[model samples]
Target chain A: MFRHNTLRYAVLVLLASAALFQAFTAEYFGLEILTEILILAMLVLALDIVAGFGGMVSLCHGALMGVGAYAYALLSTTAGIAPPVAMVGAVALTGAIAWAIGAICSRSHGIYFIMATLAFGQMAYSYVFEAPIFGGDDGLGGIARLDLSFVGIDLNDSRSFALFCLVVLGAIYGVSVLILRSGLGRSLTGVMHNEQRMRALGLTVWRVKADVFGLSGMIAGLAGVLAAQHIMYISPGLLSWTVSGEALVVVILGGLGTLVGPLVGAAAFVVLKHELSAVTTYWHLVVGVILIAVVMSRANGIFGWIEARWGDRIERRLSDTTRKPEAKEVLGDA
Target chain B: MLETRNLDKSFGAVHVTRNVSLKLERGERRIILGPNGAGKTTLFNQLVGELTPDSGSVHLAGEDVTALPVAKRARRGLSRSYQKNTLFDGLTVEENLGLATAVHTGNATQLWSDSLAKPEVREIVNEVAEQVNLMPYIHAKVSEISYGVRRQLEVGVALATRPLVLLMDEPTSGVGPEMSKGFHDLLNNLPRDLTMLIIEHDMDLAFDVADTITVLNYGEVVFDGLPEAARGSKLLKDIYLGNWEDA
Candidate 1:
């Protein structure tokens, strides 16, 4: 059921074309916005793994993202390390943090789990919020990007940097696809269906969920590492529960349980906020209304609706041509 | 292979199980029959470790298992079926049954990142699905199936665990007469070494399958003997039919 389709290809193409536009015609400002969209797409995809697929709707992802960001900042500054090493270290540390939170929170499933993760995430935020050594509320601002001299390219250039983010996004998307198609993905879906049966089968259901939830946090960490370097700034606001809620809202806005839903949601979210804020002070009201409309329609998501109304007919014809031999049984069964 | 002594449970003064005690030998099939509110389900829940007993002991195969949780109880060769069909609705039959096989094998590797496409899991799932007459419905999602079929699927799930003891409550609650007969034959032929404890409202099915009958009335045993002896006991009928005025 999960494979490369027109939607995936189209979204990838759309991302590529936008990157090309920034690389050639647009100024550094346009390139910066494009980079934010691309990286946020990665973070939203990570959020989707636990919330959309595994049925663990967490609101602490932004705080976990902070864990990654801080990991990169501290490792690079304290050890005078390169960015690549810092990114890896950050993701590993964040993965561990996510696993701890997941282990504790997965015990309490449903809405309580969401609230529990939210509380834990807030705890992380407040730790950074109050810790004087980590720059307190101002964040660790003096961190540096990886000095990638071996590649014979200056990452200081916004054009080159955008390319780095693009490549990272492509790699994460590929890995996400692989994970979603594996046996683990099937079991995670099974957990959502019946944890009791999963437990009865002698599965360490909690550990599995906690691990995957940690994996999602690691991916989000990757995005956070990229964002921290690009922005050259970090603050307590980044780890706020509202930011996590917004990410969730973006996921819901794009679509739930769809691979590309969160990406579209994030992009659409940033773009709408950018364009609408230019027109009026109350942009959120308008975005909220659109979000409400999309959810109420139960249209699967933006592309989900597009696929339902338009994509189905196309698929139906494709199946009809390829499965002529099974047509009798297929029609008879229906 | 299983026994409980002086089991007592209370929900704010309503004593669910009061000093309930019973024992069974390996290969013995005991059916617990009673009317509604007889605490049959509650007692089953306690024995299955879903509910804790305030003052009793649960032993399995001569080991004290009173402190074990539900998952451990299941792993210790205790499997149960609900009065209602408890199928994992979002999963396909093969996937659910595959999990059941994994349970009995005691494979606790449930990390979501691991693959379930191994040939071992596939082979075991097919075998159990075949055993429960669910081969034709292997690919079907449980939610899309009928209750009668779901009941069979639940049985397939239980059988996959390879339990030393099987506790089934109302296995034929909503089944058709024809399918009920099929399930009866299937239950009757289960491995003799599997200690069976059942609760059924259907008297004919009970007499046809059970080696011995245990009638429970108001959380107390009224009879425990052979099927012929149980059928001849007026007290058993009176308990089952809820005629408690004389008692």
Candidate 2:
């Protein structure tokens, strides 16, 4: 358990240093890719909490993010609200929408859940695509970054913005790690594993599901706000099913339940798509092939594979005593 | 502490549980016995709020709970183990017990706090695991444990919920004879404050543990009395072991 903690911290430190180095040296195109990766990683992290850990396997996450993006876009650009206020509005709107959706879909499981969320994604996509207030197919533009002059931060500079986004991503990851160790997290796992047994044990399964969904939606909304601020643009494409599908792919590619896996997945996905598209217009074909190869090689995703190779070696040695802290780690309590 | 009034449940033309009424006093060990498809498990389900009776009311500790959902009924001091092993197969035994205890203590909805770090919850979970003699396998995943150990864990899970009335559906169904004796020992050692309503196929086992017995045949309660009197019941003999005269 100590080994696992040390290793996790080590990896986090390394990632942070790398992020800092990239922010300092990267050109405009490189910084754009870096910022996009951080934003997408947050999105995938939200999905991982619901689909990977909670076993909801939601397909409407992109729509939830779009809810946030649209909220920010309209409030900041049209209503002339402060960017921070718009961000909060975006997160609030996404949370409410996600809770409503979860209330309707939480009772259904397996394929039915997938279909219901997929339908929701399609609904949001169509609504945004045709809604005149949202600029329809053309989308909203000229969105500015949050006024952080009080904090002495200028987000207009790409490097500063990328660093800020990275910090936000780290904060989200920290909160996620804390949640995965909480009582509610265990209850969510219980619901995912055996909902009936959870109910028998006096857990309100639907409420757990809805609460988890709302939390995930809030994070996704944060990602959306950051994405809008980073790009200064918004479109119906932000709400499209393809974005959800890509996030799912990242979750699967990184590792389902392991919290760090999605970050790796987001990085791999963004870099691969950017580089492959430069080589050929048929970038999706290459992406699909690479995904198939990675998934086939490492069934548990890259992080699970790493754990099996290295983490388990240290873990096996610690299992002899069944000490409290170590045992909790074995259960992935944190 | 539990009473059912004319509970009736049916699917299309087949009535699984019909006019089934029974009572269990606090601290008593009551067993319901029946032949195949005689609604023994179905009765247990209705009592625990797993199945809504077509027309009946359920009372737990003098509170009417027929309209409550399963979790609410559980919150009202009801807990149950399934006929099949419905464990969180991927999680460790400690985690399973922790989750049950967390829910029982109303700590299940805690999102920001680290539950495992809570000394009280951990102490309760460890106590339950120790009670069930599952301390050795606490770190083992449910799927990695032996069948008998899994059975113990199932009971441990129900016990961890701090139930006032526990519904056990065929607790000894899959265990071998030796393990069955261990189960008997475990039940014998349980806290006297806990009430148990059990469904068992083994007559000897049922009679051994039960303070009182109820017999069901074709979804109707044909007999309810002391275990000694139940053994002498001609109706029970005819329905369970076939013909009393032939025996």
Candidate 3:
């Protein structure tokens, strides 16, 4: 009888509780890992917005995140702006930049679109690597966290900062879910499914793609802000095409369109990388093997596989619970 | 009303559309009959702004939209269904209709609200579903549906846009005779004032639904007249290889 997505809500609750538990109980190193996973999860979530739903597989998301991180770092250190205001300005700037890129790249489709995004990503990476004001390859350090010390929350502490990142990630996940259920999400899905049909139906398909890309960029920017705070440094590596490629890998390894899957994917990816790299420097090869296995065994990814196994059962149970009383009432009436 | 004048398109010496001029008044049903490579689809493309004519103009509601893009032309009340089934196969039949209606009603960009929750979009989706006789399969995924149902959905999506001029390219291209008759009935039941330019191969459907007929051969309009006159035209008989009497 309840029309809400019970299973999705349940999964979100479970993930949130787990994140909170880790935030409260994790050690310093554990908190660092958790914060890294949360930030990367947010970035992958942003990637999914366009890649999974909008069918625009962008390779410039890492660069977009870099723009946010650089902007936040510069505004706080050089421009002398406050951390929170810099965060907002960085996100807006990244969104504007991504919107322009998306508008230009919208002219290309499929492989061409991917190449166009790669070109943009490489351009950003090269600029950041060569620019003297950015300290070139050395990157900029001494970036501050979103100072909430006046509110009695010391973000300098790992636990407090991790909790803050968890909160931001949760908010982003919630907003993403809302966007997916909204009209724009449906339009994006329609555009992905049949762009020609969308155009025939009077939709400016490129505009829709560009708008979603901009929204996705803002989310990636938020992730970038959190990431800079987590590391207290900004580097050109953040803008590298390899970063974009890795994010794309996480998106696929988790599952394409499933929002929560990307979080699971990011966590799995970070944990795997951390654990494997401890033993072997050739962790990329091992991760690649695992990715291949996941892609082969489950086309939907690990989260999708989990949902495929249990999602229907949970939905049916919820509906059954609601329908029983209605059935009884109908029987009594008859 | 949709009108095309002297629409000529060539692909490097091969003329796909040759001096094709046509006019459809308000509330008119014009059926285009042509064999393969006749450039009927090309003509429709030019009219809908998918392919621009080399030296011609397309007008919709007395405005020349020859320079406008596909979406802009569609916004000015020109909509088309593809010869092939071009549908959102990932979505349900109702979602397919809802998306078209959402875009048509200017609610496509609304990011905060549910599109299907809007009463206007739902109403139009339901209406178009009923119009296409797809109410029974409204909840079915387009990919899971049969080929014939997809054909109906292709038109349903176009109708949901609430177009002033609807161009349907082979709405019943592959259906059996029985289903084709049903599709014909569906077309006949549509609102009389909805102007339509249909490219059809079936003579039974062509003669049955057409108020006027235009025959295309080698990218040129060979004959254009009333259906009764088209039936008796010697040129049409020659083009059809005396298949006129079979209908």
Candidate 4:
């Protein structure tokens, strides 16, 4: 287990260093893309908590992030609240909304659950699109980044803001790792594996689902806050079902349950979208084909492929125990 | 410690569990014997709160738990093993046991630390692993284990919950005679104070482990008495062995 964790953290450290390098040396557009990747990575990480572990494929996560963005935008712009304070309020509001959604959706499973969340996402999108208070279809803007000049940091600068986003993303990633290794994570795994057994063993399965959903929402909301600040805009588009679909695609493209893989996925997705769009108007088609290829080539996604190929080799070197016999036994069973 | 009153269930026109009423005292080990489609598992489901009775009440430790959900009833010290293997196939055996022990000990809510690191949970996991004869396979994934070992794990998971009343559905359903014999020993070695209601097709195991036996046929209790009395019942022989003398 220690060896496994060491390999995971080693990869994380390498990614963090690369991100830090980009934050320090990248141009304005490059920093913008890096920040975008970080924000979406956070959102995907949150989605993994429910879809990957809790076994609930939510289609309303993009809407949940939009709710956070709007909450922050409105609280700061209309209510005249501080940006940091607004962020807290936004996350809390999103978490509560997500908890309610989870409680209701937990009653259904599989396709029904997906349809239910899609309905909620549509409702949120429609409300944001038509509501006059949210500037109608025009969207809300002029949102300012958190003022941290007092601490010898200037978030208004693109470099510092990108670095700040990276730090927050890193912290959230750390928390996600901690959560996946905790007792609650074990319960979620149990729930995911066999809901009947979990209930038989006395676990309140719905409660575990709802709790993880709420926590996931809070993380997604944090991502929303960063997105709004990064782009200085909030629109109904952010809450659209397509955004949810894209996030889900990125999740699968990276690897569903492997936390670090989502980060890699988010980067791959953003880069592909940007690079492909520049080449052709049929960028969506190209992206679709690529995703299909990825899924077909590796059902467990890119990270899973990597883990399958080299993860054991690294672990074998790190640990003294010979797992060859057991591995062979597993293969025979399969 | 577990009792059911007038439990009735029907799927469409077929009555699965007829007005089945039973009473088991604390520390009582009762064996439920039945043939195919006899509603043994249906009765176990109602008792565990998985299936609500069409019209009846279930009492656990003197409280009416008919309205309680499955998990809530389980939290109140009621647990059961599935007739089929219902294990976490992707997790190691120790994780399965650790999860059950954590839930039982109210440590499932811990979100910051490893549950198996807790001395109390580890102690119970080790103890239950020993009890179920699963010590050797504790580190093995459930998917990679042998069928007989998986059967043992089914009971091991139930025992890990430290249940006040355990309802096991066909614990030895698919095992060979040799493994079944070992299973019989395992059940015999369990704590005398732990109440168990086991559904069994193995007559020898039923007669061996049961202090009392309740025979079910066509969803109704045909006889409820001592194992010796149940063994001698002509009605049970007719329903189960089917008039072997005439044959």
Candidate 5:
């Protein structure tokens, strides 16, 4: 229902409102970093697709991001493909891998699924680490920037690319929002509560789980493609389980499935990492402490708590009429 | 019509079911009465495809379903409720019943469809909930309700499956006497085509409702007959009073 998803749509509107600040003279130097934060938000949103909505505790989402990054890096550079083609290719590659992993790993739930996804991620990491053509441990360098062919914009310039990344993030968020607000998302909520009941309901719980993972992976992969372009390089470490762990941490910190929770979490992570690492040798310690505090103090998450405060007001509105683009702002169940 | 033939199960040296065989014709009410460790639960598990019998087979409506998984068996008109309520703690009563509705129709894969949008699904759930008389507290959470309500939730879960053979494990193990009638009424009104094998300890209810009674003493049938034949034989009281009662 559009009513349930009002907050998500509002967050989208708020994020889009960032374009208004682009003209501000003082914001020029900070554009690239903020753009990176937005992309990170996209990644966190993708992670939430599985962990929060589907109840899959995946630690391999980062590796899925790696798949996208690799696809972009290979197609855009080595394969001499255009950026648009590379982007589509990246999504296809990552989404396929996500589906495969989801199908196999979804057979096991709770901690077992966690370990299975981790195992697959580690396998991807190892493949990237040892493959000679991929530059091995040194990583694949000399990755070219996106060439629009007709837009006539030089992507090497920081601000133009930052805007591009932000736009892409917005699109990805929209896609994720659409999927989560659909009938499919409701079944995912059911899975989170009780799988047995779901089976009795005559649901093929595995397929729904696989589909959830694939959706999240596609979004994560899209973010990864953008990230590789933004950084102009691809590394084997992109597929590391630690990166997946970080994504999981972001979802938790932001609050699981709370629409804008990922954005807040990404901002917290990016800002804290950039500012703290510049100042202290033990930056992770501070981030770790913050994480502990967030986890301990807020089970519903930052945005979740916000929703809980005024959820009654949102629930009062009826949203039986969903599935129309005109009602995107309605978010009741969208 | 459900039947298990020569079903044998064991846990290492301890045999849980030794050549146990039973059958329930369509519309028949069969109660299984046994001592504490007489493999009643084991038999239910085997029938529901949660446990594999070491030998022999199970048939539902004349179709061999010995190797089917639990959910698969459920799909083929076979449903069983846990002695312990397996309801999800996080969901409200309506949602749980809604899930049961989904199970009944077998559409567990619709991930995110807004429940309010599905008129057909809502109608089915409302009908079943009405039948079970759980409409009053449909929106209540499982944890917020009483033991009787919890049991009904479990039963509702099985009923949602709309099975041909309903297997209930200790349908009234911890229920108050007043709550028992609700269950009795619910069961009494069930379609005659839906056969049920109930495991229970209450002798009064067993005699009151069961058309056929199977008594297990030590992982084996001590008495298998009609309730009158079971009650007339000394073995009926012997299961409760030990060897001295039979003497």
Candidate 6:
């Protein structure tokens, strides 16, 4: 009775393509929203790794993404590097920053961790907002799209750029799934549960925290580069603590531990913000009310509610088959 | 093959662990018994690197590990269980054991390898689960299991590390008598290659499982001898059993 849902996979593929089809044909406004969703979804996925799974609720991931965007801008424009190389450089730089922050913050638990990350994020905001080399308050502009004319793909075309963003999102999703099912993911889960016990089990707690944070930062940096390419602009606003706060909200409002919730949360967030802002400038008031309602009624977020209703049964069936209960049966028989 | 020399730790004006020196030979089962505030747990903390001693050294298998961190000491074949449950609440029994084994084998950070898909890891996890009689609940979440089963998984987690010296702080503290018996049988059936250093409050369970016994009173060792000698000591009766032993 528990067969793999091939039809479900097909439906998912069809739905994904339908969204892409809409992006390709929709007006400039719709295409821009789709691009923004892809970029922000990547950020939320990055946040999910540390805050959702590792139980380290970071408030500086937005600043980390800013680091990536700024690095890309500076490296490509100033150092005369190619776009791809600049992006990689930005990710590496952000990874280093995240490592330093993680080493300090991972020492603290609960509220202390949150406060430490918030402090670091504010520090990033202050630097970017004041530093003249980064365009200070005015921010940077004229970020060019990747030159893929050699491959006959004109990235300046909106349709091609949208497709590019979609492919990147798909790749990130696949990678995230692999990571969540691996030993590293298990260790992070253990760390989240009990760091002391993980230490006793011969796993260094700080190192694990640092590595995960670095990985999260790298992924966030990837989003940063994409955002830069999409808007052709980078600003201190990108690095503000408010951006980090929003990402944290998205992760929480989506589902804290579910990998797919953040993606859904990103979509809901962008759509809500876009639609609500049109109605009134007090759009934030409505968002606040919705967040409160979600927290009070469904603490697990929208995806969590869905999981409770249907995802759990499907998950249980799949896991039951994947992990044979032979030993359990042997014990029962005994 | 474990030794602690002149381990001293103080908190401001209060001395928690005082100049404590202890030794355990290969394969010896030594239980440290004390009153509630005798600082037995503090002493264990020093041995496992959870709390560093202000002075003195911890030598495990002839290596000086006094300056080593908890995970490094564990990687060098020193492992322990906490006094509290400390099991990963969201993970399953098999997952808890598998995590221990994965870290022990230096595979905790293999991002691409599916741990559950690996047959050898699964086999070892099952084997450890069987040893602790936790096979039945291997697929159940830790939060959904009984406290007794959680206790077994705690030991199972430690054992999965394949430690040469196992340090347990009150392994059967909150478990019922029926469950304690099962814990005792599991401990008794542990391979002779494993040396155990246990901190236990249950005198009967401690005496039954331990080949040697050490008694601590107010941050100091009052007795270190065979189980028979410990049982016959008047000081032990005074501190732990009280005058009611005569009844």
TM-score winner: 4
Estimated TM-score for each candidate: 0.91, 0.93, 0.94, 0.95, 0.86, 0.91
Candidate 1's C-alpha lDDT?
0.80
Best-fitting candidate, measured by DockQ? 4
Query: What's the lDDT for candidate 3?
Result: 0.88
- Model 3, residue A301: C-alpha shift (Å): 1.5
Q: Please provide, for model 1 over A1-334, each residue's C-alpha lDDT reduced to its tens digit, 9 standing for 90 to 100.
A: 1456665677768867766777666688777877888778888899888888888999999998888988898888877777788889999998888988888888888889999999998998899999886688778787677677688877777877878888888888778776765666666776777787666554667877887788899998888898888887788788889888988888888877777777788778888988899999999999889988998998877767876776657666777767644323422342
Off by over 4 Å in 2: A1-10, A295-298, A314-334, B232-238, B244-247
- Report the lDDT tens digits of candidate 4 across residue range A154-221: 89899999999999998998888777777788898888899989988988888888888888999999
Q: Model 2: number of clashes?
A: 0
Query: Candidate 2, what DockQ?
Result: 0.57
Among incorrect, acceptable, medium and high, the docking class of model 1 is acceptable
lDDT of each: 0.80, 0.86, 0.88, 0.89, 0.77, 0.85
DockQ per model, Cα = 0.31, 0.57, 0.45, 0.59, 0.25, 0.54
Alpha-carbon deviation at B72 in model 6, angstroms: 1.7
Candidate 1 residue-wise lDDT, B1-247, digit = tens? 9999988888887877878888989999888888887789999988878889989999999988899878788888888888887777766778678667655653334333334466666777888787788877777777666778889888888888888988888888888898899888888878888999999888888999998888877677767789999887878766655667665
Tell me which residue pairs clash in candidate 1.
Answer: A83-A146, A184-B112, A201-B103
**Candidate 4 residue pairs in backbone clash:** none
Q: Give lDDT tens digits, candidate 2, residues A107-194.
A: 9999999999999999999999998999998999999898787889989999999999999999999888777778888888888888
Sliding window of 10 residues with minimal summed lDDT for model 1 chain B: B106-115
Off by over 4 Å in 1: A1-27, A178-184, A310-314, A324-334, B103-115
Residue ranges of candidate 3 with Cα displaced over 4 Å: A1-7, A313-334, B242-247
Q: lDDT per residue, candidate 5, B126-158, as tens digits?
A: 776777777766666666677787787788777
